[model samples]
Target: MDFSLSDEQRAIQDMAAKFAEREIAPHVAAYDREERFPLEIYAKMGPLGLTGGVIPEKFGGTGMDHVTYALVIMELARHCPALAGAASWASGVAGVSVLRFGSEELKQKYLVPLAQGKVPAAIALTEPHTGSDVASMRTRVIRTDEGYILRGNKIWVSMIKSCGWMIAFGTLDPALGRKGVCAFVVEPQWPGVTTVPFKNKVGFRPMETGEVAFDDVHVPASHLIGQEGEGFRVAMCSVENGRLGVAARSCGMLRGCLEEALDYIPSRQTFGEPIGNRQLIQSKITDMVVWHETARLLTLKLASLKDQGHRARQEASMAKMYASDVLMRGAEHAMQIHGAYACSDDFAVGRFWRDAKFMQVIEGTNEIHRWLIAEFALGYRR
Candidate 1:
């Protein structure tokens, strides 16, 4: 019945808020304009323990709980969702898999550096031909005496060049379907591993997304995470946790939309009076407020459920689906309230609007999430 953030969680939230204001807010516009990743920001974050919020102290992390981790992401995304997205990708989504299933040697090699933010990491699960269809991935990993040879192409991996390692999934035999897949922590600089940047993205521009191709990339047996044939489970674990992260980011965007509208309305004059005086303008502001609070609660609920060691697949889907839809709709309403000003780059509303749409597609598409929720409700899926 406790709905309030614990004292420790509040402290972490405040710290992240301060970090966002001082580090993220000022440079966000320039970074987005140039489509540049803020490497220096993450460097600063590493020293502040922001990079290791979910990592255990033994692994050089803060050992923070998932709820507190969600709070930190909320603050970071409030200023810049792209920055938050990149940070979550490195610290939580990619690092969590290694912590949960990687061997000690693999953790020392990859997880430790990731916890310290000495380098970045990414998960490569999306292929050019396969997105939602995990069983149909064309990427293949063949057995080799040395270890395994990875040969495949991964598209839309965020910050590919910047990451030191990739937690990639490939199938041993496509015929075996999901059971045949395996997860490997492959070094990005290995021979035959090449990447090409994707430019002109509609949103999330501050993060450098790219396509990576592995032509007989060599991976040692030590690099494998979890047991063989466990890649599907490993990827799903990361993804399930990742749903909460995306929800947190969506909550932040929703809050940002509300704050922007509130700030803009009073200063904007129409018909010899401030727009805030108009009932129609007030309605938009009220809607933004509602979405912000609703999404925030759903995100925290999902995080709390996760912290309790409960099965949260259905809850995570609901949170991600509802929050993403709220963000997209909230952004549009905020844009409409801004009138013609929203179209200009001089304001952040346009950027927020574009990023909100992208949020709906990442982590998992809203369509997939809808199906998942429907299945759960109908007792057709566990």
Candidate 2:
């Protein structure tokens, strides 16, 4: 089988890689340490033509393919997973949804600014009561003369503070189940909308996850994406895109672990020679290489399927599960190689370890994905 990136993909990968090393690498650690979002950097990416890679040129984007987008995400994530997460949430999840289902007016209003990095958008799915079980959400949206009135609380909403608009989900009637849900383009600055920061996060500190509360927030009719009662489908579509993004980020984390381990092994001397000479250290490093390569390939496969207009729901789950699992493994191995030093902020492995665990939890937990994969294999699901 041929395994070569297209010229466009290679160019994006190279540009992203160099940009990460030169721009992201120097400031990411400081952002993480300060637990502050790298708000300005995202806007700066617009001039580099990196902000609108997901949508078409008509929507103020370059119309880059999914595989190329994945490559760029991986490169950004190698140094700053939080920054990569923000970019993916803005471009892949929320931005793509607008491109797919939004009206021309909505596209001109929100998507164009988002593509230009003048405005950030967020996908509001997770709630305090409902995590992955989105159908059971208690947030209610009622039809009114002016428009829809939204009253709900969304927790663990990433980039909330930085986002000007939110692609939010709410249920009109709980008895209708998923059919009762609808997606709305919510203005965060509207009256009765409030946000609270999630303090002291374990990882992804620079991404700024928060809780958003909507109390009688009026949403105009023009902001509704797709038809009423189609919120579940819209949310799932965004989620599929997000799953691939997470997989790419996991691949980046694995690469970082390998690179960090390689740099440390030779310089760290044990007994009479370098620790790299030992069989155990060599074995861990070898496994890390295998994990990184395998995860990267799986991520690319998912991206390719997406570019081909395939649904990719099942394959995205598999890629996300396997890649995230590999990331956790690589982080653990890096920690073992670094020994005591891994516990301190002096090394990057500690952050990777925490972030890898977070990866498994988000974009649907690994356990949930495993069950879904099993169903797909058993011919019970498609």
TM-score of 2: 0.97
Clashing pairs in 2: none
Per-residue error at 55 for model 1, in Å?
1.7
Off by over 4 Å in 2: none
lDDT of 2: 0.86
Tens-digit lDDT string for candidate 1 (1-382): 4668778789889999999999899898898999988888988887888878678878867787888888888899888997677557544568888988999888888888787777888778889998888878988899899899999999988888688888889999999999999999988899988988788999888778889999999899988889888998888876657998899999988888888888888778977999888898888888888888888888888888877878699989999999999999999998998899999887788999989998898888999999999999999999
Model 2 lDDT per residue over 127-158, tens place: 89889788999899999988799998999988
lDDT of each: 0.86, 0.86
Q: How much does each candidate deviate from the true structure in C-alpha RMSD?
A: 1.2, 1.3
Candidate 1 at residue 74, lDDT? 88
After superposition, candidate 1 runs with Cα above 4 Å error: none
Question: What 10-residue stretch in candidate 1 is worst by lDDT?
Answer: 84-93
